[model samples]
Target chain A: MVEERMNTDKMWITMGPQHPFSHGLWTLRVHADGEIITDAEPEIGYLHRGWEKECENRTYAKIIPMADRLCYSASMTWSHVFCKVAEEALDIEVPERAQYLRVIADEICRIQSHLMWLAAVGTDLGNLTVFLWALREREFFLDLNIRLCGQRLTTNYPRIGGVRNDMPYYFERDCMRCVERFETVGLPEIMKLATDSSPFVGRMQGIKYLTAKDVANWGVTGPAMRGCGVDYDVRRDDPYDAYGEIDFEVPVLNKNNPKGGDAYDRFLVRLEEMYQSCEIIRQAFQKLQSIPKEAPSRVKVPRCIPAGTHMAKIEDPRGESIMYLVSDGTEKPWRLKVRSPIFVNVSSSKHMVDGVRIADVPAIMAMIDMCLGETDR
Target chain B: MTEEMIQAPSYEDVNKLISEKFGEKVVFRTSTKKNVKAINEKRRIFLSTDRDTILELCTYIHDVLNFEQATSVCAVDYIDRVQIVYHLTNYFTGIVIEITVDLPADDLHIPSVALIWEGANWHERETYELFGVIFDGHPKLERLLTPQSYEFFPFRKSYKLRGSE
Candidate 1:
């Protein structure tokens, strides 16, 4: 004889598709028992734009613009990645001076991108002051981008085998000023607002803890993996562009070290990464200043790639972005496959959200910092 | 973790090993244009065998050749035949190997490698749904990343898009 059990009530809460804090158009169907979430299911494809199909229709030159949309914040990086792979398939060598300029533009983009993430994360946490401060500081980097490429977000600065244009005489000086300001004034205030605040620390610390083993197993990269204490940074491991020539450190948080992998660890990593990016920019800027301003920044692209396949991997701010190019000896590629890092990083969201409070979801998701454009591309 | 431990095997060694490991079953070998000197050199190997040997080849690749990660699994459709391409990469060595099996367009069936590498689960499902390739032994073989009610295999050359149709 079995005794009858009482049916505990369960409430369904939907957070996304239009929510301000939610990343892109993802809808979270979470089952809650009282205040705690018992189960959660992520519903995607709300922001799918069929970029892959679109790529097949466009020429190689035209596809760079679409790559810009994939990760809008990191437009130059994606464009560079796409163009680099295309160039590799064509066996075209990018000029040394052009590579330096590319590095400068990419580093500037990284600085602005991390600033945007900081602002968004702060805004999600209801810290309007920090958001304003971050955006204010970010304007400096945006100005530099405007000076270099004439656009802020979708510059399409990177071209196949080179850049769209050369930098102005004032570019180096202006970039140096931005880096100096970031180090001396901007970063300290942002750090104080984020890490020093008890409320922010309480909301972030120990929440969404991903082990290093799990990070590698799932092919996770970038800050998400660094947040799990994995010291694997693609720039250091697989150098491309001017990264091999530049001097910068790969910031990691080990349990034995001062910083342990957590939301705070991720925050700390990005903070340090900004400084390293600045250092890279300084080196690249110095290199660029030495080169003649009249030097050609664009390469003459061949009509068709050799009949074969070529794959190139670059460390974008997100993670390891692999672009696979297959040419059937035609002007257009037979098949082009982009192995986006956000796709792999976004897969770890399930691990991050487990056992965390419902309110902290926004913070955790923001900390993961996945660009839906890259994920769905 | 050390570079010396991760030996960068030449293309000749790779071909010889494949020939030795699976004597008659081994079909042909082709080289990819992309080569990473520091990492494992990239190569594409084509295997012609029955459906039964699919699992055995995958096992041998994973267990012996040390193709630890399954990068992607995609199917390409030709006029009369379909080909399933398994793109595998070794993490430490950075070597990429493509194993392809050709099948008739009428009967596009191949065994799944999901049991060996869990990452292949979604990829195989995607291939199955998009190319209409049937995987014989895929656990929980369901449509992934696509709508449940999606009627047509959109990826196949024969399946035309809205404008083309």
Candidate 2:
């Protein structure tokens, strides 16, 4: 009976498999009653290349590059997770120097990714300043990546047990300089743009809130949870790599956000995270210096990984990423499973966007930092 | 290796507490065979429970143990039977407890934990499409990461690879 009373024009509209606001290839079929969204359904797989299935065909070492392709914005961390899993599965001990180096690479990737995300978020909200300014700083780190790893985006840098190369000559000075600029100059400007403008704050502040309960129930992690004032970071809690030795604070919402984590708090979280990432790298560089000069950068890994089921989780800039692997006593894995954070993060949008204006959809969606490369994988 | 005595700081306590609290409901509990004390504490816990008891167990884990998120739902095809594994974690403690519910080939159905963890929704759908496991209570158990019209379970062992005969 209610169905009969509904407006004839009320129907499900496909937002995008190719919408400008969509960061990647995915569609959102939102059921709306005029401009108010009654329901939202996210559809992914437009970019699905079957990364997990493909991993079965590749050797243990060969899959490192494949891992990088999962999330290009933060490729180092994805590959780092795989390397950590493979290392644990093989029972190989990574040297202290290598662990410190891996921390340096992963934290640098984290900052670059957050900047790229801030840039993408800026572009979505029609704020060109954030977009340009964020990337301007982002390029600095990208170049530092080239200096450190010889590639820009998909750096197949971290080998199974250790890094491919040690800190290059002048790496410390160059990296510290980038760190200082990001903390002192680059981040302040972005935060100012986020804070100063009424239009930006008007759109971002109060609406599209996901509560702490929702973050927990949705398995949301990274900036998404911290935005809601729930402090959780795998670097500190799980302490993989040199995160145990590193001292840093997990930043949360200082905006007195009562509606849980809104788009703005998540924004603040990422901004502060960029600062924290710098601190980690700065301390790690000092630790890197204390290590003996003759330390080996790469450790020897066996040609084949033994048969076993293994799981490892890492805090990606997007969220908590976990990989489940089953090896069949061979060079190739029997089954490889990726628990991409974007997949779960996107799913919760159904609840996230409800009761909001149709126009606010893009604003809410982009804040979760959707990387469909990881999601569809 | 220069660093010795890697600290895992009592992850085993979580497993022990869960078993003591929900022993009758749990079907099986096991950890990593890696056995190196440092690695052992970071060991993955595999808990088995029947379809009837899964929802209850999930509620216990989420409500009581504070494993706030259902990180991923993994389905594995073992030829004769399929195993549906739910990796749940307490972000505060980094305590990961993976709950597995095995379904025979004839009955590829299990109760969905989506009711407990909203994050499990898409994960269950992805597992459903790739491994052919039916998540009975999932509100929308649709295929993700594949063409909507694609009919094959490509991740299953039955799917012939290009190099295979």
Superposed model 2: Cα runs more than 4 Å off:
A1-9, A254-258, B1-13, B21-44
Candidate 1 regions with alpha-carbon error over 4 angstroms: A1-12, A31-39, A255-260, B1-104, B110-121, B134-141, B161-165
Span of 10 residues, lowest total lDDT, candidate 2 chain B: B1-10
| Candidate 2 lDDT, A195-240, residue by residue in tens | 8978877778887777786777877777888888666788887778
lDDT for residue A69 in candidate 2, whole number 0-100: 92
* lDDT value, residue A223 of candidate 2: 87
**What DockQ results for candidate 1?**
0.23
Fnat per candidate, as a fraction, reads: 0.01, 0.69
Clashing pairs in 2: A16-A27
The candidate maximizing DockQ is: 2
Total residue pair clashes for candidate 2: 1
lDDT by residue for model 1 over A329-351, one digit each (tens)? 87766667677776655555655
